[model samples]
Target: MYRAHSTVATPSWFSIIAALVAVMLWSAAPLLAALAHTSSPLQLTALTLLAGALATLPLSRSVPMARLSKGWQASVWLGIPLLIFGAVSSYFVGMRLAPAAEAALITYTWPVVFVLLSQWSRLRTLRLSGVIGALIAFSGAALLLLPQALNDGLGGAANGYALALLAACCWALYSWLGQTAPVALTPLLPRLLLVACAIAAAASLLVEGSPKALSSEALLAGIALGLGPYGIAMVAWDKALRLGQASIVGSLAYGVPILAAALLVVAGMSVLDWRLPCAAILVVVGCCSAGRRDG
Candidate 1:
């Protein structure tokens, strides 16, 4: 949920290249899902967790995840499910409620959530610039949500937005809890447990209460969920976030919507739209301002 900033202080040639690569993938995540037609968040979540769990086998067995502290073990068990469910449920649900652009934009509110929570918890003092950035970002997010809000007259797409907001809440909580967790920056066992729980949850939800059978497309999409955001993305992000500024990571995360829009166009699922790119610019600006305040 919290993508960390690039932490290579000296900025070697490799670090510079890695930073660029990270930004590109980070930006592209939401678009990747839209392009993939990642419809069922639950299925996507389950597969991600399963994949993460599978990834854990070699590392856990070799490194012996058991060697970690009890506190870390508990954190992993708690945080992993939070990651899977929070991501899967909210992302898919938001996609259903609104356009991918809108969902992605809405979800970026996690930064604001983090800032607020930090202030409340005495982790940091809230600043005027941060408040202003939040307001501007909220206004821009509101504009994107306007269509969904209007569409509520037909169905409760507005309610879908609410659900999406709820998903954001889960993400915020996940990030915050993870910060306090006692494991190393990258904890394979805890991450594995979280993914395993998510996989079980996703499997149960997808397989049960069925009228239609599982489509091959959906199955593949679930695998993408497991592999993409849930698998590699988490590891990369955790490693980075552990070493960098959460605000910067949160801001950079907004790039996902724009990336998703571009990918959607390439896939011919959607047309090129200008609003999301514009919103992304605003998100980046806000993130920069917030990062400055924190720095």
Candidate 2:
């Protein structure tokens, strides 16, 4: 049976901190998209993962070689590397093809996907509120995609939207598998990240050849993404999940699109679109409603 077990009692403060970390992690989307303008998506993914792997080397060292080897072994058996590669690659591709804000909003549907998958797998049960909330949130997602569909008819931004949805599904599966895997993720994360980096690098080489020299802005942004969102943020998220209820953590994910949008606007990467606010409101409300305790 797939069950989530927290090593420590969850505190409201800790949950709040975890939620904030999640927001920060996702807020990197627009910045990453902006960097994609100067670098290929595959190259950017490779560089970011490589940076994250290097940053986490110290932690990896603390884990015994035997355990690390087991982690690598588990990654292959469990297909973690492929899952991470697909999710990250698709996300970057989608961001490159569409507005960062739209991609973020679409990918943020992972929580809902996670909940639904858990229920379908019999790992968890959803309350009536959860069902209602899922419907509402999904409706909001449709609203966000509807404009693109109407404008381009599956020829333009629709591809990006499809990729974003694929990314979301992949992410949901990854999270679920991580929770249920026999191997502990703390020891496995570094190995999995390194593997993902290798995959990204190979894909980049195949698709883009040797990367061209990047602009100063692109270089700095890539480094920041590696150290911040792809690196420390991941560590923080894992810690939080280990210490908190997965449900609460998942619920808090509704804040991601909002944070991502705000960050994009502040960075001057996106303009305020009326649809965004409306979609944000609907999604937030639906997700929050789904989280309500019925008992």
Clashing pairs in 2: none
Model 2 over residues 120-213: C-alpha lDDT tens digits? 6763566777788788877887887777678766566777878888988888788778766655666656777888888888889999998778
For all candidates in order, the CA lDDT equals 0.58, 0.71
TM-score, each model?
0.76, 0.84
Q: State the displacement of the C-alpha of residue 186, model 1, in Å, after optimal TM-score superposition.
A: 2.0
Q: Which runs in model 1 stand beyond 4 Å of their true positions?
A: 5-8, 35-40, 55-76, 123-125, 147-154, 189-213, 238-254
lDDT per residue (tens digit) for residues 32-111 in model 1: 55644534455555555676556444334333558878876666665656554665566766766666666666676666
Report the error of model 2 at residue 247, Å.
5.8
Q: What is candidate 1's local distance difference test score?
A: 0.58
